[model samples]
Target chain A: MKDRSGSVLRLAQPVRLWVQRFTFLLLLATAAGLMLLGKADTVIVERIRVEMTDAVAPVLDALSRPIGVANDLIEHGRNVYGLALENRTLREENARLMQWQAVARQLEAENAVLRNLTGFVPETAATEVSARVIGASGGAYVRSVLVAAGARHGVRKGQAAVAGAGLAGRVTEVGDRSARVLLITDLNSRIPVVVESSRDQAILAGDNSDRPRLDYLRANARVSPGDRVVTSGIGGIFPPGIPVGVVVGTDGGLRVQPPIDWDRLEFLRLVDFGLGGPLRGQGGAGDPGGRP
Target chain B: MTPAGGTIAHRVDAAAREATPAVLTLVLILLDVVPLRLPEFAVITPSFALMSVYYWTMYRAELMPAPVVLALGVFQDIVGGGPLGVGAFVLLATHGAVLTQRRVLMRRPFAVGWVGFVGVALAAFTLTWVIMAVLHLALFNPLAAGMQYVMTVALYPPVAWLLLAVHRSWVQAR
Candidate 1:
């Protein structure tokens, strides 16, 4: 019996080894096939990504609340650390700014009146979905984030995702309970942007870098560094006038620099622009051209 | 006990033992999904799951099968938001390398093992980087890949120690 078992083991060992080698090669082949398949129809991959995101979004949302609290606590701690100096500075500034506050309040009241008279409505109605960033696509090739929001929370693909400070990115893949945010710094991310001062239109392109470059700038456009860049609301992706980033420098004839600190991204607010169509809703009634 | 009966029991015992590694793999998968915010050194957060698999495959090769490694890799790919087979490819390769080198690794000193880990990690990182480059040619940046490689290597010692400690305790308990 022992001799028979020994012979069987010896014969089986080579077969097992061959199977192992074959399996490894098979996995490699499958990986190559997937790469080719993914490239063939990018849309299918995007759809699968969305479905996966939507499915996992709720779990991400649950996880985000604690992150949000932790962020608030950190911010509060920072505030506390500078409270003594801030208190003294604020007290003197308040004494001087009390006069300006009245003017500011007056202007705000007047602006409200004008908005009412012109039938100006904010693009996104009050309903907002808050999500927590669970994981980051920390690879050099992709600048996407996995957030904890999905179909249950009304987070759909193509929705604008913004951080606490300003625009972060947009939802590209939505699963049942989770979604993926393709940040403005991703190679594939592109936003229709307008230079705040000049209103010069261009496409903000992400090249898998911290600062996305602005492309398609018309020749002789008067865009300069330090100019504000906002969504143009042309592509029906993001709402108009949403702050994206500040123009830091013109690189290769492209305006660059993001307003939001991409490195320290933690939480995000997915904006729900009420208008289900292009953000260029009939310009607020007051402006003859409806241009903000 | 009869010899024939004993052999069958032994086979069942081996199969049951395999389940322990599967449980460990699942726990690692859960850890990958959970955003456990480590205070410092966040960028180079050594992949705990990868280390766990590596350690188990080295000590308990029979239990840590190739299929489990591939499945875990797929799970990581989905969670990490990379192409589906990228992690699987990296991990299967790592498993194969570890298996081939296990006898030497087991006999080597701690320092030698560390060097072996560095070599393995470098190979894995290179493989992953190459696959990612092919997937996104325009987006591939060597500097970022280098930084990640450095972080992974720098992090391996501490991660290896932790895995060793866990293995020791688990083995003792068993």
Candidate 2:
């Protein structure tokens, strides 16, 4: 009886290993299958993205706090060290800016008079939903940031996310308490913009670089380096005239330098410009930011 | 205690033991998402998720089985905003390569095992870059992906140390 039991036990070992290996292969196959299915751009895959972001929002928020504080401290230290030089530079900049302020005021008054004669309906003022940036997925494949604000906080997909400097990204995947913003420099980003000085219109397309290329410009568009680029608002997603980038030329073509630095992003103001953002359904009752 | 009670307790213990590697891997992936203060860390921080999976599979493959590794890969694809299944397919390939040589690696010293990892990582990263280009339907600057692979291989030693320490503390007894 003992000899028979020993033989049985020996046989069971290999059998268990084989079963486990088989199961592993099966699961791997299933995972690959899901990936192929995801390429269909179905609602189900989007739902999965939203649900998973919701589940992990709180955890990411809690973890990002210290990192944000650390960044602030470093910035403060640098500021104090350069206080003297900064004061002189700021004084010069302030004087220059005052002249621009006077010019702007005069232009505003003229614009108002022109609008009154033209019976132009002014665009609605944008409402801001402020939130901390908790996670940023940066790589060659993706350039996206996750903010603490979400569907629960009146944020919806396609709403523009802006920093103090300029336009940062647009909300792509929104959960209950978190939303993912695809930065302008991501591999898949495409935005319609016009040059501030020349008024030359073009499409800004990201190629996973710090500077995104300006594509489809008219031949001899007369665009120059250092010209400002702002949203054209042709898609009705972003508000018109929001600053996007500055023009820079390379050997290949013109590229735009994004106003906001990727490393310096801590907080974002998700703007509801009332342009009828995409994915406006479900949750956050009575939020009019997304309704058409 | 009744016999049934003892069996239940044993079952719980077994489940927890099986889950240790999964929890570790998940934590590593979470760390990858946070924007820490280190320069060039965001894009080029060595692939923490990949290293953790490789290490656990080397020492304790049973605990960090294929299904759990598969889930980690899909989670990466979702969070990182890449084409789905790319990570899953690549990771499984690495794990399979490791499994074929696990016995030899276990018998050899750490240096030999590191060399083995170098081989598998090269193949995995090449496959990943090719898949990414195909998915995006355009050729991207290869420098970024190449730098990422180099950083991942170089940081393996220190990260493996941390993982080893955690494993000894939280899981050695279990």
Q: Which candidate tops TM-score?
A: 2
The CAPRI class of candidate 2 is: medium
lDDT of 2 by residue, B1-174 (tens): 112455777767766756878887887777778777456566665677888888888888777778778888888777666667888888887887788789989778777777877887889888888877877787878787788888888888888888778778766655
Model 2 alpha-carbon miss at residue B120, Å: 2.0
iRMSD per prediction, in order:
3.7, 2.0
- DockQ (C-alpha) of model 1? 0.35
At residue B116, candidate 1 shows an lDDT of 78
Tens-digit lDDT string for candidate 1 (B17-128):
5466667665555444544443322233456566667777777776677877877776666666667677777887888899899998877787787787778878887887
- Which regions in candidate 1 have their CA more than 4 angstroms from the true location? A1-11, A40-79, A88-126, A250-255, A277-292, B1-17, B20-26, B29-45, B171-173
Q: TM-score of chain A for each candidate? A: 0.73, 0.88
Q: Compared with the true structure, what per-residue lDDT tens digits does model 2 show for residues A204-269?
A: 888878789999999989998899999987656677799998999999899998887777678899
lDDT of 1 at B125: 77
Question: Each model's DockQ?
Answer: 0.35, 0.51
lDDT of each: 0.70, 0.80
